[model samples]
Target: MDLDFYKKQALQKQKEHKKFLDGLKKKPPKNLDYQVLETHEETFEEIDCLSCANCCKTTGPLYIEKDIERISKHLRMRQADFEAKFLRVDEDNDKVLQDLPCFFLNDDNTCSIYDVRPKACREYPHTDRKKIYQINNLTIKNTLICPATYVFVEKLRKALEK
Candidate 1:
């Protein structure tokens, strides 16, 4: 989607999310995991990530030691060299790309090192996972980055109201 479209959707989703959270706080429901997963599945059916790689273009995942080693090996470079060239330690002491539009993201929006990508990259959006209610903060962040997450929340709100 275009930047304008994304901006509009982001604003709308933000309002929806606040309303949904407020409603939940007033009358919380049981069996939230089933509700979230069902909504996620339905939303995923409609999302097309290839059309919008906003996350890869706007943010980087925290890279663990294993990710450093694996990705370094994939690039045929020493781990320290790889880290120096493409990453920096964040305030939390985790490795992340130096800037937005992660270095590994190709022009086509595909990961250049998909096989050895970080754990966080592998679990992005995190909507279909079990225990969805436990990561409500993550859901909020992902909703801002991933259209699928926005769609999931919208569907979830509908489901919860039923």
Candidate 2:
């Protein structure tokens, strides 16, 4: 999906969808996980993230210690050097990329550190996980950043309504 288009759509839909997601959290359907998994699978089938690495361009993964260590090792750099070069502490005190357009993101929209990327990067959009309600807030945020996630939630909203 296009970034500008998705941003507009997500901005318009967020209020209604947030209310709906809140209801799901309050009384989740038993088939919720299964439904979400199907949506996630189908969304990925049609969504090629390489075409639009908005997540890498606009935001970044939260780097855990393991991520730092693994990435440092992969690059043959000291952990402190890696942190100093690539990361900064965010408002939440979590280690995040130093700036937008993550340093490891190549111009071709490929991640330079995909294999050793952060846990958060690997599980992005987080739509198919069990106890999905637990991440409703995060999913709400993701809709603006990831179009496939927006589609998944919209599909989910329609399915539950029926």
Candidate 3:
């Protein structure tokens, strides 16, 4: 995928997308969730995450306590030690990774601890989540970092227009 091209397109369309999403938030369609879920499924069928792990490369997932515990256990370390070594609290007061490109991201773009990865990582882009209109802000941000999100939003707009 041409990331530079995608970035340019996303930046150009940012305001338009945000406007559409804001409108969607005020009066979403009855089938909004269903359409978004279907669109999410179709988008993933065409896009391969392994080919472009941009989200992992550019952003950090918010690690909650359960995620910390799970990952700590998976790595055979105490939770405190894991937090000290890999996590820092952000301004949002959420625990996030210390680095981008994710410490666990392997050379092949696969996660070293995929099974024990944080919940936020698992639900990234979040287009398929219920009441997606509620997450318009997150979706807008993801469009810059995730081509799948950009495509999904475009597909969803088309789907809704019909």
Candidate No. with top TM-score: 3
Q: Over all chains combined, what TM-score does candidate 1 have?
A: 0.85
Every model's TM-score: 0.85, 0.95, 0.96
Instruction: List the candidate 3 regions with Cα displacement exceeding 4 Å.
Output: none
RMSD (CA, angstroms), candidate 1: 2.3
Query: How do the residues 64-103 of candidate 2 rate in per-residue lDDT, one tens digit apiece?
Result: 9999899999999999999999899999999998888988
In model 1, which runs have C-alpha deviations exceeding 4 angstroms?
A: 13-15, 22-28
Per-model C-alpha RMSD: 2.3, 1.2, 1.0
Write down the worst ten-residue block by lDDT for model 1.
1-10
The alpha-carbon lDDT assigned to residue 119 of candidate 1 equals 92
Residues 18-81 of candidate 1: C-alpha lDDT, one tens digit per residue: 7676666566577776777778778877877777889899878998999998889988999989
Order of candidates by TM-score, top first? 3, 2, 1
